[model samples]
Target: MSLEHSGGENADSDLYRIRHSLAHVMAQAVLDMRPGSTLGFGPPIADGFYYDFVLSEALNEDDFPEIERRMRRILKQGQRFYREELGADEALARIDEMGEPYKREYAQELLSREDLDGLSFYRNGSFLDMCEGPHVDTTRDIPRDAFKLRSVAGAYWRGDSDNVMMTRIYAWAFDTREALDAHVTAFELAQERDHKKLGRELDIFHLDELVGRGLPLWLPNGAVLREELEKLAKELEFRAGYERVATPHLARADLYRKSGHLPYYADDMFPMMELREAGDDGEAVKEAYVLRPMNCPHHHSIFAARPRSYRELPLRLAEYGHVYRFEESGAVSGLLRVRGMCMNDAHIYCTEEQIRSEFKGVMQMYAEAYAAFGLSDYRVRLSRWDPEDGKRREKYVDNPEAWEYCEGIVAEVLDDMEVDYVDGPGEAAFYGPKIDILCRTVTGREEQLGTVQLDFAQPGRLGLVYVGADGAEHTPYCIHRAPLSTHERMAAFLIEHFGGAFPTWLAPVQVRVITVSDQFDEYGHAVVDRLRRRFVRAEIAARSDTVSKKIREGTTRKIPNLLIIGEREQADGTVTLRRYGIRRQQTLPLDEFEAWIAEQIASRALP
Candidate 1:
């Protein structure tokens, strides 16, 4: 049964019950404050609970203290929650009489449906509302000190813009107050490490209103990060026998329509651009072009661009191409969700016999990348098709046999590798099954770092064919993999993962040279020049400031290494080194330090 129907009775744990029950108590408190406020869905989320409502006056977070007092009073009264079942018609009548038009409309809609059996109503004191209940015996069971109202947001009823707008109040609750306090502390750390804030302080990237929302302009430092990532991907892809290819950012609308992306993905895609041209009959004809939302269709066209023999069966085309999507303003958050992005995308066209090996190679590539990035905690989720799920069945290609065959092939490959993975039904792409690499960031937010999708539908639909050894034409199976994710998303993750103190290999500024005094200015310039000549991202701080202040500036910018060139170090031809986030500093010979940094860069070593 769904959580909405389980009513906290069979909750998996005490925390779930506490969160769910707190949602009800908070709803009751809101109703008391505004007599006619109409309540909507109130469900417990990952770390908190939220209740949506339509009230006469807007609610501010500053008013949470007063609301908490009322909730404490309710808890003191020790009100017991009692449940009663009623017919759908009777529930509708009672809802209308109570002046909750939204609830009345919901009950009426349920009554029109013939599948429902009965409606349950929960009562606590004079407050009675429709709910499926397994609430606590009394309000005293709630920990009044453990919960807090977090914030309020504007949400459309049923999440549709055309529907009435309502206020959604978010609050947090836990089985213990300590857990709640810990969550708040971690949230503050996440804020401090937020990429949007660090991106500016480090001169990485910026999002400007004049340029447009969701389109970030990469600064010099950000471009260096992008270049380094792409360089790594290219070297790895080249080693995996993947050839680099480039594709346009816009394509003819017919391309997507033929691949069935138009019907399912039109909303997320940018609007089409129409062009009129003269046809063979001297009549004006219209053609529609749209910014590409994905790269698979273009890659498919490239595959079919020329006839192919089975000898070149596994043709892997890779690109760090840009794509555009129309994400809603509210859903956009920094680089994580953006309209423009550069995908570390590649498509492998191979015969059916080569699918397993190609997929294995893709998996190996992903593993190598994760290792290089020091990301060891991750899981692979096999997203398979669910024939019994009507929505998914309709969304996927209508070929149950093909779905079963592809899923079996993927399962066999995964087993052969002896890697652990969980099966997730109804998570497959519209055209095929896929494997998503899931991991939680340092901030405790779940992220999809990489994905490998096996497609049997799109290649054939696009007329992509290769001549078999038996002299017969066959459509090649395509494997779509993106091990490094996108440039924007990966940067965002890296920013937070390292807490902006990047390793020397990936750090935008590898070293900062600080002069102890004017007498050491020449020495500092010489040190910076030596490092820069060796291709190290080094800078000199010869300004008229205290040595401590210059060193503090370097540490604040998160430069991986700092070199202090003073009279003693200059006289000895040695550099006093300071590492970021480290308390101790050491002195190393000038040549030794350069060699050390060179090795780090060459090996892409983690700090």
Candidate 2:
């Protein structure tokens, strides 16, 4: 839904008009190549534009040069676009002259629906467009050197399956050649940092076709990285006063029914598993088990499992919960969006008074995790109910005061602690307000990696209560959090974050011991064995190739450190350390190298 531009609207946005005009020129170029090309729609996107077209023939990379040449030829002439106020029949006849059936059909459809006393067309020389107004005075404004024909992708019409598929062309246009060149340079850098490429090259992880899409099978090296992440999460949880717990992968349908998941979020949940009772089983039960899509429901059951007083308020229970969801085939991405993922999830039951301190504690936990990963660019967002929507009367607990009080509590904490954040409306979950962390990757994409949500209603729905100081019934507020998000998404992010050169603790193989020649084999083997004894991840290259070849292989794999032992180094009991992506080699005593390696492991550097 967009505002109609009847030659009068706020078209004067803060942008160079030159860029916008180029979009129309690009669309015209495509139409010229194949006049029969059925046009779906084209619109200016972020920084550039794209047009979806139903073409008779598919194209590849080789077609770009010809398209660019065609576009330049059209631009050089500086065609005059005359506005033609034509009748409905005239518009249809003009569209039919171009032999574009889709355009003719669309114009006819618009005539049938609208009270069209007159319809206008913009004819730039011979090229005409059914545009709603606001173009440059002429075609000369388009910069010749400031654009590039980017990629091609297939997109459904109006993004619906019921309509025909269209080939969408992505193009980027800038005000100057410098800006365009900078964009292309950034794209090249992003390609180098692609996690999927690094994962395969580094052998950190792999997805087997037999294992299935969205379900990644960790190799031996990848398992090491996962173990390190879990170890760090477990330690951090313990220090934060969190008790570890485990939940089953499947739960009865009744469990989700109470949590209100089946009715609202059933599409995302996996297909159910049905079961019939064994004759000897109690009650001759008929049953179904749905793969758990979340862990909050199970945590609520734990709270309801026992009676408690306010003394145990702010009970922090944590788990590395594994969840499964049925993601669309198109939505499934390498590691970012997967069917199965493990999140560093936790739940806290706190009283209204404990809200501020609990939120501060979670913030501290978030900072610690990000610090460990060497991530600097991040901000917290306060997600609240839409102010325009009137105080949302949905799943929020009956306690209106609690909701108001808790929001103030969070605001005060943010001000008191000097936490940086921006407020967002209509972004909060139905149950409560939330704090979402937006993390930016090295490649410049912003992802809402994790969040902490305050829930009062869902806990009440399950009849969870804690005796208050007044010795009466009171419902507890639950805070759901996943600081590290899912392991699948986080790991995928980290694989590219560090560019596969993981810090020592999570480097699959922290150090590789390579013999400069066959003569130094004994020393290399002994060094590897000693490092292994000290619990360092070190491996010897199994290939019987030249030492330089082995080093190149390690470089390709993005291995963090390489230890080379030559004949002189073997006799001297010294090792030359080569850091990843850098040629500078440092010579360290055997004991010092082992100590530094051990210290890195002890510190639990980024996974």
- Model 2 segments beyond 4 Å from truth? 1-15, 33-43, 52-66, 81-123, 126-137, 154-167, 176-178, 277-285, 386-416, 440-445, 604-607
lDDT of 1 by residue, 288-322 (tens): 89999999999888888888999997999999989
Write one digit per residue (lDDT tens) for candidate 2, span 75-122.
798876677777877777877776766666666767787877556666
Give TM per candidate.
0.89, 0.83
Alpha-carbon runs more than 4 Å astray in model 1: 1-14, 83-121, 130-133, 154-166, 277-288, 377-379, 386-394, 440-447
What's the count of clashing pairs in each model shown?
0, 0
Clashes of 1: 0
- lDDT for each candidate structure: 0.86, 0.78
